[model samples]
Target: MAKPKILVTRRWPAVVEKRLSKSYNATLNPTDVAMASNAIATAFAKYDAICPTISDKLPAELFPQSRSRVRILGNYGVGFSHIDLDAAKAAGIVVTNTPGVLSECTADLVITLMLMVARRTSEGERQVRAGRWTGWRPTHMMGAKVSGATFGVLGFGRIGRSAAKRAHHGFGMKVIYYDAFPIAPDLAAESAAQSRDSIEAVLHEADAVSLHMPGGAENFHLINAERLALMKPTGILVNTARGEIIDGQALADALRSRTIAGAGLDVYEDEPTIPAALLQTNAVLLPHLGSATRATREAMGMMVADNLDAFFAGENLPNRVA
Candidate 1:
């Protein structure tokens, strides 16, 4: 039988790429650039399966009006908000994502961001690199303390739980969280996290707030100007979740006006196109490196490969989201 032709939207880890090449006729993106919508629409007719990452935006308009030859969308990341699931479902396309594997790494990044922003390490590094450091004074670049502070988590899922553990056990911080769904008492006890009634409650009390919720229309701009106002003036916010969860402009304004002390973000509302206003602020920004670790990224790719294998073999997909 002929091998199933597959198209990987972005360049994956070398080991996983080699593994994929052995199983199917795989076409990996050499440029590692995001594929255009038109090209993605074209892939529907050409490939048996199309593997996409968080960077790819597969909207309803991109799906073929007619039935597509593509059978499955093997998403490389846990988040599938970038894809139009309804369109995929209507077109009889299966959608699967990689989860669980990236939880620890991503949570680690959340801690990294929190610490960087709280300690003003980014600013200190820049000062030293610019040859402007005149040695440390007693009051030199004094920043907020992280240990024993209240750590608020917006979503208490796998990544959130991991972050909570780090904060409570490693840093001796207090853990509090708010989740739309209820978490088991035993799970909450792991970090001694107390569940708040709403997002406002968490924002009002925490010295550092971390976001780990899903994105999409319902959550678009969930943390707008009003919600941001609820936060303590000295509080710091960190977002490793979907960028659309917070309004970029509002956050920028908050930072500029000292409404909030600082922010550390790994994701943005628009990729590679951060707001100029935000750039002017002292907010610590990273280029979406939530799961950029070599081991974690390779694991994510392997999960996608496993999903694709199960899909073609007529077995139950391991992480089917749609």
Candidate 2:
């Protein structure tokens, strides 16, 4: 049988790239740049499967009006909101994403952000880098205490539960979470997290809050001005899930007014284009490095490879979404 043709939309780790080439007739994006919508549409007509990252936008408009040659989209990340599942279903295209592989790494980044924002580590680092730091004093760089504080988690999924473990056991912090669906009692007990009935409750009670929710129309602006107002003035916010989950402009204003203590964000509402207010604030910002570690990235790629293998073999895909 002929090898199923596949196109990797962006550059993946070299080891995974080599593995993919060995498994299938794979074409790597040499420039490592995002493919335009038209290019993606054209590729759909040519390839059996297309591997895409979060950076690629695959809206319903990009899918062919009728069925096309692309049988599957092997997404590299856990989130599938970037691809329009409705359109993929309409076109009879199967969609799969790498989920379990990056959970721990993303949880690590969540904790890193929570600590950085709460302790104002970024500000202090900036001062030191600019040679503006004076001698250490009692009042110098005083920040929030993480120990014994309330750590709120929005969307108690795998990443959120891992963060709760860190906060509860590692830092002696109390963990509380709110999820759209009720969390299983065993899972909640495992994390030592108290489940809340609503997002407002979590916002009002937490000393620091982390977001681990899915992104889409329903969750857009989940943390807006009114919601941010629900938080205590000393509260800190961390977002490693998706950018549209929080209103960046509202967060910026809150930071400027000291309505909230600080914020840490790994993702943005607009990729590569951040609001000026957030850039100017003491907020800890990252360029979506939640799953950037070599191990996690490689694992994600291998997971995608597995899905493609199952798809080609006419077997059930392990991570099929559509």
Give per-residue CA lDDT, model 1, range 225-248, as digits (tens).
999999999999999999999999
How well does candidate 1 score on lDDT at residue 131?
98
Would you estimate the TM-scores of all the predictions? 0.99, 0.98
Deviation in angstroms for 74 in model 1?
0.1
Per-residue CA lDDT of model 2 for 1-322, tens digit only, reads: 8899999999999988999999899999889988898999899899999999999999999999999999999999999889999999999999999988898999999989988988888889989999999889999989989999999999999999988998899899999999999888999997689988999999999999999999998899999999999999999999999999999999999999989989999999999899998998879999999988999999999999999999999998999888
Runs off by more than 4 Å, candidate 2: none
RMSD of 1: 0.6
Clashing pairs in 1: none
Candidate 1 residue spans exceeding 4 A from truth: none
Say which candidate scores most in TM-score.
1
TM-score of 2: 0.98
